[model samples]
Target: MNYIWDLIIKSERAGIAKRDISFAVAEVYSPYMELSLESLNARTAERRVELNPYYRFDHIFDGMFDINNDEDVELREQLFDILIHFLADIDLTQGLNKREFYIRFALRDLENGAYGDKVMRSIGLFGREERDMIALNLLRLYETGEAVYLLKDTMRKVFKRSTIYANCEEKDELLVYVGQEETEEARAKVGLIMDIFLPVRFHVEFYWNRHFGILGLEDTMRQDGIAMY
Candidate 1:
């Protein structure tokens, strides 16, 4: 995206602004501003890929277990540690300092050798399609109504298996049935829907390896008095 910073001139005695000089300066400094803008965008997830793809994808998976990604948390911690250590001594009295100091150590504990689950090789980059998909999905999440059927539909799009709500009868609580095969990314999306999108008055909980209600046999499979489960 070609961009330029307009030069404004306001002089009392000699108001002279040459188009040729203005064009030349604009041409020279345009690239600098472009790079500067990109550098500023480096601080954000949407444009972080331009400077570092590793960091961008790491934010998506909340630090994948891939060593290739540090699971994402390691590199950030390393840089933060160097900056914190620069303070001469990490005094745990200051709130920000204390949080950063302890959080770094706790994250390191999550490393856990990365023996079998180390993220190796490419976990893939965040391209235009992934970005667009997320945007569209977010639109669906926000636009979709908050009824039982609507919530289930949104979850179906995110997870392969159908998400059964157990506590639908209870007005104040929602119980989500869980399956073990879901990916971390999928779980993260589900968590976002439950934690961020759900109304404040409702309590959401997840239960695994159990069914909360009686199973109803499908009408299509019922024949004579016996039905397939």
Candidate 2:
């Protein structure tokens, strides 16, 4: 996501140190670094086949040793794109958690300056109940080792749907499919979740089929520009 990177660049320009940005970026991409080269090759190849039949992973990984290396602009850009797509395609809750980690890293480095305050407000800092919920859920996750399941369950209840789908898009926004039910109600539920539960800084969108399997099935209802809670 260029927007995420742009935020880092903007923060640096706003007086945050380059090392801090690098550290945050490193943390964001650390999950990729842990994967084996063979695993990366296979996964990237599979993704390329689905996305671009003509794209070759070999060209991107041929001489690439470090993705963070800046000497070869082409390699770096390609690798960054791969990582971005990889992150986008993963589980929604996991992706948002990683994003939250990145935001926290930036905030820690920025501290209490004007830029930091702006970022803080943009991310919607947690209040007492939200903070307590986070702590309680973390403990539950540690004890049961089902953190994703817990989040998915909470989401299911909030949307009033037994089966709902969630995905993180390329723009780092969360998209939730709430079926063909009451769209306004779904929006309100999402607003509440964003306000009380979401720990990360990113936008969310609710998608529904307005026509409900009718002639206008191709047309989808989308609600965006949701205010941060």
Best by TM-score: 1
Local lDDT at 152 for model 2: 54
* Cα error, candidate 1, residue 211 (Å): 3.4
In candidate 1 the C-alpha lDDT for residue 46 amounts to 21
lDDT of 1 by residue, 41-141 (tens): 33222211111222222353343334476354656644533432232132222355554444444333323322112311111122223323333443454
List ranges where model 2 is wrong by over 4 Å.
1-149, 158-169, 183-186, 209-229
Q: Write the residue-wise lDDT of candidate 2 on 1-229 in tens digits.
A: 1223333334433444323332112223223232222233331111111121112333544444455666967666566555544443342235356546654444443334433344334323333334334444544545686644555555564444433333455544555556546554455545544443343654555555331222343443224422221
Q: All candidates' lDDT scores?
A: 0.37, 0.40
Task: Count clashing pairs, candidate 2.
Answer: 0
State the lDDT at 6 in candidate 2: 33
Give TM per candidate: 0.31, 0.25
lDDT of candidate 1? 0.37
